[model samples]
Target: MPTLSMLYNTAIASAFVKILLFPCYRSTDFEVHRNWLAITHSLPLKEWYTSHISEWTLDYPPFFAWLEFTLSWIARLLGFDKAMLDPYNLNYVSTSTIVFQRSSVIVLELVLLYALCAYVRSMPARDQPNAILAAIDIFLSPALLIIDHIHFQYNGFLFGILMWSLVLAQKRETLLKSAALFAALLCFKHIYLYVAPAYFVFLLRTYCLSPSGYRIQFKNSIKLGATVIGIFLLAFGPWIYMGQMPQVFQRLFPFSRGLCHAYWAPNFWAMYAFADRVATFFLPRFGYSLPDAVNSALNGPTRGLVRDTVFTVLPNITPRLTFLITLFFQSLVLIKLFFRPTWRNFVGAVTLCGWLSYLFGWHVHEKAILIVIMPFGLLSLKDRRYLEAFRPLAVAGCISLFPLLFTPAEAPIKYLYTGLWVAILLKFNRAAPVPLKRQFLLTRVNLSYMAGFIPLLIYNGIVHRIVFGDRLEFLPLMLLSAYAAWGIFWSCISLIWLYFTDLD
Candidate 1:
């Protein structure tokens, strides 16, 4: 296990790297948060959600807006540039603005660092060393590097809260606090609704249900329900009092968005979209001309545009259908956790629930892969099989994030840094046992899947540009997304099978 001083020194090094990356590529998310600061600082409390001077309106839940509102005071009082708080200052990014915004992510990520330490400390003595490994890997996660620092979101801060909730759920005395923290997390960003079913089932089965028999713990159930409702009320109370609840809900859940983002998230839909493309266009080349509507194949879903998905050869996917599919798969994990709500099983259910949602959720952002990768880290240390499951996901999830840092200056950092992290994880993945033949077969298949990345990366970074230039600009993204989807799918299946059959 790493000594406390080692963890502190590593964190300092991570922060230094983040400071250097301040001048690196940042996404539109920079302006989004800057706009939030301005809106929260310059506007009245009543108009927080109503302001629309900038296109990046206040869409996050009330707690996050409140967080911004609180930070706005610090920005104003601390002598940072006050112009950054102008609601109409569209795309205003001065050096001070950049410093404040970037610095805020680095500092708030201390929350993530804290939560990881706490979770590691809370682990049983036998699991302490392995838990420390999870903490370190998650802290140094390539996904966080590309997505949070370069892409510029508060994901580290939010996921920190998630880790805290998970830690609390481990003990019976703190289960209510766990549920409350999770409820607050949802209000902070409802995307966490991905694992809501798991929490609900785990809390219901383990906490609210009598431990010995099937009798209901009505008093405990009411207490749990009230705690969750109270947290939501605290978050939404002001908006509800102003009678703008519908407005808040609309901004929070914009179903008007497309089935996928401009860049396909590396999940099931990426592969699904690819298959439709092949069936639509490739069939005609083999003299399988059937439908002229296939003429629209050129403008199909994988065009890398952010618009509602339209399928040419397959059934169109609606948000309703996606929700049902996500819920169905997540229900399987939840059912297992409902029966066996051990700490181990709960952690597995959380990871699988997030995986199912990311794979099947409508309009999933590629960054949501962190949802799978972070939670799965806890389970990976159990044995060789668990580490085997994590290996492909860690690799796929890491490489899928490479596209996020597409600038030449950031490419070396993502590639080398993520490469190092994966190597350390592979070393740690050692020491677990399996049958010789099964281990051999697994290693061979994993190596082959990983080997494909060489040509894929080469083609994406070099050959595609040399051959097609800007013509098929979206091809690289499609290839990366589809490839990662296969590996994540494999990991999810293996983990799910382990969850069902593995002894607690």
Candidate 2:
């Protein structure tokens, strides 16, 4: 078991590394939040969502806008010029601005650190070592490093709130508190809506209805419903009062962005895109030609556009179809949780829900892979099967974010840092006792597939630059996406199988 001092030391070390990464590569996301800070600071409350001075409009929920508003005050105190808050101050990258934004992420991540400590303390004495390992896994997560520290986002703070909610929901006594925290989380970042189904169904079955007899408990249901409604009302009340509901909804659910993201998130859709490419390649050999429109869509993903994706050999996926597919898979998992309603089952359902949504959701972002990886890490502590699946998924999913930080400066950092984290996790797993007999074939295949990442990284980082240069620019990204997709797809299957077959 890790002592409190040990946990504090881990957090301090993690924060120190994040501080060192302050000058590392940052994505357009840095500018996005800067824009938000500008919008929230300069614009009036009514113009918060309506302002279009910058392309990165205040699309996040009002609470997050409020959060930015709150942070801007502190930003101003830290020597950021008030002129930077101008609505049209696009791409403002002053030294003070950079330090302030990066510092905010580091400070706010303390929330995640606290939540991690609380979760570890909540565990049983025998499970503390595993909990500590899980905490380390999350703290040193490559995805978090790339997205939050380097690429730049507030996912650490957002995911911290999520971790707290999950910990609260783990016990029957804190169910209401859990619901309130989750409701707050949704308002903070609506991206979490993807996994909302699990929370809904779990609370409905275990809290709102009798667990053994399946009878409705109206009082409990009413309390849960009211708590959720109150939170939403608090979040949206001002917008509703101003009659900006339509604009708010539009900003929140921008279905116009299309099916797959610019970089195809390593999910079912990436495989679909790869399959379409294969068919497009072989169809000429089979004496078949695709329609020009279909062929045009095939070029879209390769070009990395944030628009509707068209398929040459497969049916173009509609937002509705993606939604239904996501819901269907989530329903299957939620129904299982509905029956069992154990803490492990609930956590499994949450992980599956996030995984299914990420796999099939429309306009998915590569950063959203953290949605699956974080909660799944929690489950990995309890079962060796989950750890087995988690090992490869973590590696592939984290590496898939590499293209986001493709600069020479960040390339080595991403690989070296992730390599070290993977080594630690692998060492820990090897040292832990396994109750189930090892499946040698599966182990060999998983290791082989994980090993392939080495060559893939080499090719993307070194060979591609040396050989083809910028001509085949998208080839490395495509290969990375396709390869990572295979691992994630397999991990999803492995987890679903474990969910059904493995008994508590």
Candidate 3:
């Protein structure tokens, strides 16, 4: 039998194979990007508003506008004409639009890929290369590659910069470079702003909490501030100069006036919506009248008289409302990081809380999966005190992948990515260099979280039928239930363990 290390390395290699080969699965929603390309490429700079795309595309961080603008130039070169493009019928499959768009996203991912590889290469020699490689393999695998490059949006570029900056911070070198990268990430996607608290904690410890004991070093703070300002100006200057500030805001924060997407992903928000319906059905003690139902515009094989029993206390709860609520929960996680400031505790809380927010929010896209899984990287790299905590994080990350595979969503290669996660978790558990006591703890905690899924699966697959009058329909809901429950439950377990044990 190959050593676990060799197996881990092989898994990593296989993951890369999947990423490179998986065909982009085009969705009806891809019209949004097509419309964006049409607007950016063909329209006069001032006329871009009339050709405005989906609201989601509008609210991206400012750096992405520059990216879109830059890509638009190439799209124009490739015969992209806004006059010929119809925003109402922008399905990528109908035109060459998707190919160019996906190509642009793939190029962006290479930046993330390079940053990720650089960070991995910087890992301490004492750690398991096999496990690190396995984890990285999972990150670069087909699921992430396809979701980022084809189906969803361009998040990898920003995420890449963030991770690279984080690694630089961890290494305590080139704080200015790290700050610049951090600003660039924020400029690309504002959603990542939720995790800024953790970044602040990282900078404080690595730079200000000097090895020189007592004296406070104020110079690093100035360098950090100046770097942040420099990058923010550099990224935003062009848009500001274009006199597109108003247009930019309209795009970046165009909150939809709706409760949920036509198709709800298996996530926390779905469960919460379900629970809200059940609550209103069983007990309306507060004079809560159910709101008008929003139709999903269903027209397919699965289309029928599908009834959502979800009740709303507030009749006009939109995506913006849910986003605000999610932001509130995210604040709690940030507060936890603020008080504790340890990488292990901080990263875990952010992962759990950030995921919980995304899971329950309205108009959620499957692309939101990254918010939950990305934190696992930090969790993996932090103190060994986190190994037990991270076991569940890894399991959750793997489970999150299942919904993408075998589902109607494009990018079928997600199965390979899912397999990579399984392989990494298994290999990490087996090949850890620590004592049996620590290893057993990690394994036990992982089992505890993984086992919790059984009840969740049963609830979604069968019990949801009893409760909601639909059995098979709620399978996706069940997956989300399992994910949300495990995240919250295991986090409690980790905190308790941290409190009692000498994790140091």
Runs in model 1 deviating more than 4 A are 290-295, 431-441
How many residue pairs clash in each candidate at the backbone level? 0, 0, 7
Model 2, 242-353: lDDT tens digits are: 9999999999989888677998898899989888777777887888966674556446676687887878778888989998999988889988888888888888888899
Q: Over the full model, what C-alpha lDDT does candidate 3 score relative to the true structure?
A: 0.55
lDDT of 2: 0.86
Cα displacement (Å) at residue 353, model 3: 6.4
Query: Estimated TM-score per prediction?
Result: 0.96, 0.96, 0.71
Question: Global lDDT of each model?
Answer: 0.86, 0.86, 0.55
Across residues 52-155, which tens digit of lDDT does each residue of candidate 3 receive?
A: 44442445655665577777677766775544244444443444565566666656765666666665566556554643553464455444655554455676
Candidate 3 Cα RMSD after full superposition onto the native fold (Å): 6.3
- Model 1 error, position 75 (Å): 0.8
